[model samples]
Target: MIIELESVFNTEGLKLPFDYELDLSAIQVSGYSPIAQPVRVSGKVENKAGIVNLTGNAQVIYTAPCDRCATEVSKEYNFPLEHTLVVALESGENDAFLEVPNLRLDLDELVEEDVNLALPSKYLCNEECKGLCMSCGKNLNEDQCNCKAPVDPRFAALLDLLDE
Candidate 1:
């Protein structure tokens, strides 16, 4: 969806609502594409005294395995969206501005960028996940392992002192 903002580019108190579905499969983070469904972005763009502002929410259903236990984890992200739209800037290096090329703003691009920023770097099945036992290769959450963790050689002397 390319928003036609030329009408409201210079008008104050003018708002135009835009809807778009952001495809996030192209980008991968942490060896997984978290988006199981299309990221729905519904919001509006307003020009306030020549400043084009986009405000909305990007929502998606993320399904992936937990970082620790390898169990399936699902998350719904309704990320708040706020962006500054500009026709042209002195420099394109700044991250703060979203350049509106040819008098239009790409809604899909904006939503993708916003959702990327909002998603968590790490996904957890739960806060207290015990993960897998190193020795037995068993999920600790499901069953306790009988294999004891081997003591490091550096700590062997101190451990022997306790045994004495």
Candidate 2:
């Protein structure tokens, strides 16, 4: 999803409106593959005195397994994706600007990064998800387990004394 920025770069104070679909199939999460969806890329790119600027958002709906309950869950994300594009050698390798080759912007890659950065470290089906039971592998939210609960190792000594 590379777009040519040469024309946009030629004129000072020039602005170009762009909209495209971003594919997120390549990004990987811990236990689940994010369902590939077309993320919206909408914004205006401008050339201000030889500097390439972009102002817009990368929006998408991502589906993945819940980290706690293992249930399939979907999350909505709309992250701000703005960057100052700079020529690699000319910018002196600063983190404040994004460097590009051949005056092109990888729109898909940029949006993908934004989506990844916005994703939560942990995903839960809900705030109250009870998760799966260790004893019988039953979903605790659906059914309660009657199996003896495993005592914490720290409390094992107290349980041994009580048995005696």
Candidate 3:
């Protein structure tokens, strides 16, 4: 969705509202598509005292397998989209503002970037997720495993002293 901001940029106090659904099902995160539903974006671009700003919210439901236990987990996320729109930059490079060359803003692209940054680096079923046991390959969260971890040779002397 390309939003033409010609009027908003020229006229002070002018506001351009936008609401749409963005399809990002093809996006891959950590080798899987977690976003099964369309992203809901609702916001407005307005010029306040000659400065144009875009503000909105992007809502999505992400469903993916947990990183540790591989259990499926569904989570809802809402990311606030806020950026200052500028026609041109005064310096060499600036990350604080978004430059619109022809006064056309790709709303979907901006929203997608915000969603990706808001997503967690690693998804887990729960905070205290006890992953599978390395020895027996059993889920430690469901039940305790009988396999005893191998003791290092350096720690063997400490174990013998405790037994005596």
Candidate 4:
């Protein structure tokens, strides 16, 4: 969705409201397409004392595999979107503002970027997730495996002394 911000840029105290669903099912994160539904973005672009600002929230529920055990996990994510809209900037190094060069802002791009940045790098099924047992490839969360922990070869002679 391209939002025309020319009117809001010119008039102080003017507000433009926007609400839309953006489909992001094709976006892959951490080797999985976690987004199961369209992201709901709703917010307003307003001019406050000659400064245009965009404020809104993006929400969605995504399901993906757990980082450790590969178990499917579903999570809801809500991201707050806030940015200063600028027609032009004196310096190009500022990332704090969104530039609307042609008086049009791409709402989908902004929301997608924000949501992607806010997502967690690792997803866990639970805080106490035991993950998978390395030797048997069994999920420890579901069942404990009979594999013993590997002993270091340097400590083998010391272990023999205990047996004697």
lDDT per prediction?
0.80, 0.78, 0.89, 0.88
- Candidate 2 lDDT, 126-164, residue by residue in tens: 989988765577787887888788445458677778999
The best candidate in terms of TM-score: 4
Query: 1 or 3, which is superior by lDDT?
Result: 3
Structure candidate 3, residue pairs in collision: none
lDDT of residue 154 for candidate 2: 57
Q: What is the lDDT, from 0 to 100, of the residue 7 in candidate 3?
A: 96
How far residue 44's Cα lies from its native spot in candidate 3, in Å, is 1.0
lDDT tens digits, residue span 73-117, model 4: 888888999999998876764888878899999899888889888
TM value for model 3: 0.85
Off by over 4 Å in 1: 91-93, 150-164
Score every model by TM-score.
Answer: 0.80, 0.75, 0.85, 0.86
Q: Per-prediction RMSD in angstroms?
A: 5.9, 5.0, 6.1, 6.2
Whole-model alpha-carbon lDDT for candidate 4: 0.88
Q: Which candidate model has the greater lDDT, 3 or 4? A: 3
Q: How accurate locally is residue 86 in candidate 3, as Cα lDDT from 0 to 100?
A: 95
Superposition TM-score, candidate 4 onto the true structure: 0.86
lDDT of 3 by residue, 1-164 (tens): 99999999999999999999999898898789999899899999999999999999999989999877888989988899999999998787577699998999999889888898888998899999987776577877899888897445468778889999
* Alpha-carbon deviation at 126 in model 2, angstroms: 2.0
